[model samples]
Target: MTDKTKPEVEPYDGGEPTELVTIDIEEGTGEAATAGATVDVHYLGVDFESGEEFDSSWSRGQSVNFPLKQLIAGWQEGIPGMKVGGRRQLIVPPALAYGPAGSGHRLSGRTLIFVIDLMGVS
Candidate 1:
């Protein structure tokens, strides 16, 4: 894969997403991801309500590798069918993200936006 710069996540203003929303920004010709596969990716995340950045693999100067099944529900559902080298955006509601208002996770009850670059799938 070619070296890619960090992506910026645009604020979502179309109201809170009730479900997982996936938008492909750049398409890829490599293998597509599956729910059960492990993936290597670079991503940036921001709060939908505040447009504040929450996390970024690019800031750490490394891509992350993890099993899809272990990720948040939105990712499990959204990342599948996305090809390696592709860049995609996901708008995830609280339910599919960190859970409801009292779920204890810092991002609970918050809608989130993520720009993910698929680097590898295996």
Candidate 2:
């Protein structure tokens, strides 16, 4: 959310990311993923463009797994196609993150950034 007059950054300001700048994933596209879809991802989430680091699985030395529908819109759309042991990134936009509601906390109304690594897909 910059002045709009400034160059279009990935995440933008007000969207003050930790790193402060910019930055997707694999396989199944349209269809929904199943519960057994055992997904292994190393992610780095932030406010976008600012390339900050709100969350990173790698930093914690781990990955996450869950049903497709349970994830965010961006994740539901982004975390597909990844075969078991595959890895990728997810450059999520604001609309896809918290939508209009926003997270209310530190998330507020900011665009989110995520580096999703598709480690494994069941």
Question: Which of the numbered candidates is closest to the native, going by highest TM-score?
Answer: 1
Query: Can you give the TM-score per candidate against the true fold?
Result: 0.96, 0.61
**For model 1, how does the per-residue alpha-carbon lDDT over 1-122 read when each residue is reduced to its tens digit?**
56779887765557787989899999978999998999999999999888889999989989999999999999999999999989999999999999999999999999999999999999
* TM-score, predicted candidate 2 vs. hidden true structure: 0.61
Pick by lDDT: which candidate is best? 1
Residue 116 in model 2: shift from native, Å? 1.5
Candidate 2, backbone clash total: 21
lDDT of 2 by residue, 1-122 (tens): 11112112243335333221222223323333344465655566765545556776666766676667777776776665444433345555556666554456566556676665555455
Q: What root-mean-square deviation over C-alphas does model 1 reach?
A: 1.1
**What C-alpha lDDT, on a 0 to 100 scale, does residue 94 get in candidate 1?**
95
lDDT value for candidate 1?
Answer: 0.92
Please give the lDDT score at residue 48 for candidate 1. Answer: 89
